[model samples]
Target: MQEQKGKYEDLKHDELGIKVRSDDNPYLSADLQQKILQPRRLSSYFIVLIESGSITYHLDSQDFTLTDGHLLFAMPNQIFTPPAKTGDLKYFKLLFDENTLALLPQQFPFLVNPSNAQTLVLDNPAKERVIKVFEILNQLLISDKYETDTEIILAYLNSLLSEFNSAYFKNKGPVNILNTNLSKFTEFKLVVETSLTEQPSINAIAEKLALSTNSLYRIVKEYAGTSPKDYFINRLMAEAQRRLRYSNTSVKELAYELGFNDPDYFSRLFKKSTGKSASDFLPRQDLSGK
Candidate 1:
């Protein structure tokens, strides 16, 4: 059977859309219970707000525990799994495309600000505001009062996100260590993101930082908990994945564009790093070797 694509369903009631579901939207989740939700690919971002109970999230070989009032943001196109089942869990999840978020930044600049690392906790006041926003959206969705007109919805979304952004900033306490380390990490990610096509080396990054390679690696490891090479490779693989999934560039072309002299070697490296071949990662081509 062909599955539903880009449809949001209220898990508790199939006929009823989640209180505030958008038309053919990209953002939302079906409640999972008892059993573990295995690792799988998703095409949209997930903003998970845990209302009650607890859930464990496993991503990028890291484990995070989310309990009541906690929130998490998961980027699109990544593999995620809900680790070992505990008890009943209730969550309000929003799944939106990246473009939807992009559209938000201009109106609510804080949404796009990288420095806002805090997440919203479900306090009475905060919860009330969020629920109110959802309620308004529900009315809009059901009434079709703003049919095909996203301006009102978008305005409400921005207001909700602004509140969320504020809460996030407040909950995160002053961290001297993170403040310094984050600066380095951001610079490193920026350099790698901007220079990946050139395939900049560790030495090159160190030079840009005006530090010796050894010193730079030590600092990065202290903050990022990963070696420079590993970090850069992760960045590179991310780019490769994006291109593979979203573009028509052949493997050879991708390799060349990524500054690999030998496309075959790039292919092998990519497979080794991700445990999936280039063709397999693309949504269009189903290698499905999970």
Candidate 2:
């Protein structure tokens, strides 16, 4: 089966939302083939468990090939674009807001600092447990009286997320060594995201992270498999895509907005990183005609 490119929808859901194969969502079809495969961001936190097939998923600037047993997560304000999909793909998705996360008794550390790798390749046992939880939540949401039954929905949501968080953090490298590596990497990413406009130099970033320049290099390489400079550039490029796709801003304007000193350089960099010129790169989020 092949996926058809459907019209994009600005899907509106209540704060706490759930959807499974049986739902009538534009993103999910009756036959379980994905529609609305486009580049866009999610307003709410998004999680999906893939049971089969492949997905060329673009989260920020990184492209991840997710298949069966993979659980992918996207925090709010993060850009998530499902650019390509296979007809064989089967998945369950859950979307919720910060308030729903707060309803849980304990905060999940994985949510606070997403691992270096966003997708968790779960073991068979873990996959079965996740499937069971998702089924129950799906049943709750599709219930006729769900509006008044939000508390029960939320309780199950918390439990489902807890299971996901546990599976995501399990057997992830050597925890003793990875704990430090993961923390430093997570902190560095947050700083880059928050201070991306400044376009901080490698030295500045290393100093802010309180690591020696050489140490910073290894840490970034360990997590991102790229130099800090390249990683930051990629981050900027993802932002560039978001802005360009959402509006008709000129190339020069985009450069300045992202704090690049030279528009020409920004244009070259964008083209180099994305394999397409900024002007020629098509927008995916503009749905005014719809």
Candidate 3:
């Protein structure tokens, strides 16, 4: 079996760490656009709104079709494969890095993607509003004559994300911005992500988050449908899958990289979690957009 590794891409515009593209405007050059059509790992947040027509996008080996008034978003480090061709597709695509995200005054919880939904269906009114915001962002970033103030750009960006956050959570459930349980759950995910490699115990995580073991378990199970220990195992396995798909690192090296002391133990855990041996999991063919 031949391995197909994905190229890692970073934000092109370093000054703003953001880029917006629409049907009328081509953000990347012909060469870069071709690269985008291939399988790659993105180091920035990616969102696309389908205003009209339709297209299918390949993300992490799953195909998602978006039609008019639909939106799709992918977090950083996910494998992305743009459609090979867009026939009469009208859309808006936004890309921004974490550094750009930090400039906003308040955090948008939806960015954490608690619902595990990668796509949102926008109503007519919400669709119109989102399109208008995209147009404004497009004009602000692509202007050659006037250098838009960073503050002005950030304001529009903030508004656009707020709209997305609201629409994303509206149908899922009632979300109070100050809900204590939700906040604790979000904090738990963040802490796990921050120290994933360390493989902290459930009690340690609960202590760090100022929650009891039982409270942490309930919160994690409610949101993730798994206990705290299982959540950590699942997250580690997911990261392992991502790394395996994008790189040629051997099982031993990969285990050590993920902070596992014993390669055999990591292999067993991987098999238990993924139902495939580390070696059998490689040479993934779908990564080539097949």
Number of clashes found in candidate 3: 0
Where is model 2 more than 4 Å wrong at Cα? 1-38, 51-68, 77-90, 102-118, 140-155, 169-171, 176-178, 198-215, 271-290
- Which tens-of-lDDT digit does each residue in 137-189 have in candidate 2? 77766666535355566567767777876776777655642367667877787
Question: lDDT value for candidate 1?
Answer: 0.60
lDDT of each: 0.60, 0.70, 0.83
Model 3 Cα lDDT, one tens digit per residue, 118-235: 8999999989998998999899888887666777777798898989988887876666854887778878877877798998889999999999999998888888899999989988
- Candidate 3: misplaced stretches above 4 Å? 1-14, 285-290
The candidate 1 region of ten consecutive residues with least summed lDDT is 9-18
Cα displacement (angstroms), candidate 1, residue 225, comes to 8.2
Best-performing candidate as measured by lDDT: 3
What is the Å distance of residue 129 in model 1 from its true position? 1.8
Cα lDDT tens digits, model 1, 1-290, are 01222422222221221234322232345444322254556556556666668887765345677887777665445555645435676655555554455444332322322342324466777877776776675565556433434555555666766666666556446644225455565566557755878988899998997778887787668655788999788768877875675467899999998889999999999998899998666556322312
Return the candidate ranking by lDDT, descending.
3, 2, 1
- Quote each prediction's TM-score: 0.51, 0.65, 0.90
Model 1 RMSD in Å is 10.3
Which window of 10 residues has the lowest lDDT sum in candidate 3?
A: 1-10
**Candidate 2's TM-score:** 0.65
